[model samples]
Structures are given as structure tokens and as C-alpha cells.
Target: MATGVMTPDERAFRGDLRKAPFMLGELEGRWKLESLEWPNALIDVTARDGLPYRLRFDLTNYPAAPPTARLWSRVENAALAPGLFPRSITGSGRVKDVFRTDWMNGTALYLPCDRTALAGHESWLQQMPSKRWQPSVGITHYLELVHELLNCPDYAPPAGA
Candidate 1:
């Protein structure tokens, strides 16, 4: 475990991790947690198709404030053909376009992990059957949700699809 002074919530979260070793093992098998801060955890998980991906979880206000998940990867945009000179020299000019050229490197998606009303803005963790999060729900439930999300067709796009 990472050593440092922990807040009440952080302590609770750690307790959850300890209480559910099996669940933790499942997550570890899939998304290996690399590091853990009081409010942040860095994890590397293999996509269903075996593509490795990194995820950053912001658990600062956890429970009350859903952890924010960001896809941290430098995937080359397949939409752009190889050797095709980018129309925008600085890459900034392509910001208006639907397909981002700079997506070849840096963050790709800002997952909405909250229960927002906006379409496509809802998170699997905050969706049906799993949306009933309570104070008692611990890291196990969250990890299970992550597992489901990684396997769900609607949540996780088919590899290279």
C-alpha cells in the first residue's frame, strides 16, 4: 500500500480495498493499479482486444463526487491515412473538425462518470443495476463496474471497429 497521511475518505477507501481482496485481485488481473495517491489512482488495463490502455481516476471527492476517468493513451487516429500531410500545420487549426489530428498523442476521452441527464454523458458506473451506489458500496463495487464497462459493447467500443 502507498504510505502517506490519509483522509477519512481515503482511509475508508483503503479499508474497502482490504476487505475485498478477491475483487481487488480481479481488477489487478485486468487493470493493474500502478500508483495510488489519496485522491488519485493510476491504472493500466488491457482492453478486451488486448490493447493496453491507461486510466486516471480522480477520487478526491469520491462517492459524493464521482471519480473522473480519463483515457490516457496516444493512439494514432486511424481515420487519417498514413503519410497524408495534415491540412493544419499547427494542429490547432483542426480543432474545429470532428476527427482530431492531434489525437495521435495525448488524452483521447473524458469519460462522464456522473449521473448527468445529457445524452451520452452518463457513465456505466452511474447507470442501471450499478447506479445504486450507497455509502456502504466500496472499492469492490467500483472495480466490478470497471470490469463491466471494459466488457460492455455499448460502453467499450469494439477494438478497431
Candidate 2:
């Protein structure tokens, strides 16, 4: 049932999962944990306007460096409209398109932009408690912040704001 030999990071990830089992729940209209691959976890959520999306959390160096979140699934016109969705932030604090569409499949993982005119902003990821992350913060807290960002319009900065 387990995949190959577990790395120390994987073991830590499992321990974190155990400490926050509720993070995996499907509580009707809420984000649900889909799959977990050691330092990466996938979550499914429906945007406020009813668009479905997948969120990937990369937990490598977690608790030290905040997890990097990437949006997944096809982008809807509404989702791409200026202030509708989250955007990705560069390491230098600049905003960048979340997906590199030109890359080959699997090689390039990003939100689909067929219908969107603007890239969504990633206020939540950028504002994550990176400087404040501690062993006690855990994934549950991180995900709760994500839920707030997606469902609570006021939580995310208006695109370009």
C-alpha cells in the first residue's frame, strides 16, 4: 500500500497528516483533500461562482519555507477575469502567470487559460505565514487559509490591487 521507501520528508508528511486528519474531509461545498504524494498534496475545491479547481501544495521545506500552491484545472472566463481567482508570486515578490502553457503536458502544469483574459492573483500564497510558520502551524492551518481565500472574496486582493 505504501510507495517505495519513505524519505524523512515523507515520514514527516505522514505525521502531519495524522495530526490533522480532518484536513482530508469532504464537508459538502468545501475543499477536500484528493491525493497526497509525500511532500505534495492535492485538494479539490469549487470556486465561489461554482467552478471546480484543484490546488497543489508543495510541502518541501515546509514549516521553514511556506508551501508553494499552484492552481490546477481548466480556467473559466469568469475565473480568469481580473479579480476572480488567485495568482502566483515569483520568489522576488513579482507576480507571474501560474501556468507556463507552452511546455509539454506533464512537463508544464498550470491552470488552463483558454477562456481567461487575465491571470488571477495569488494573494493567499504570497501572504502565507512563511516568516511565522512553526512546527505548530501544520497543514490544517495552511489549508484553512486557502479555504478563506477561495470562498471569502474580501480575503483576496482585487487583481492588480
What's the residue-level lDDT of 148 in candidate 1? 51
lDDT of 2 at 81: 36
lDDT of each: 0.46, 0.48
Error of 2 at 30 (Å): 2.6
Per-residue error for 154 in candidate 2, Å, reads: 3.7
Q: What TM value does model 2 have? A: 0.51
In candidate 1 the C-alpha lDDT for residue 144 amounts to: 50
lDDT of 1 by residue, 1-161 (tens): 54676777777766766665535654567656666766876665554555444555666656665554444433441222322211223333321121122443322222233322113544444555344344466444545545554544433332243
Residue 5 CA displacement from its true place in model 2, Å:
2.0
Off by over 4 Å in 2: 1-4, 74-131, 153-161
Judge candidate 1 at residue 49 and give its lDDT.
Answer: 51
Q: Pick the TM-score winner.
A: 1
Would you list the clashing residue pairs of candidate 1? none
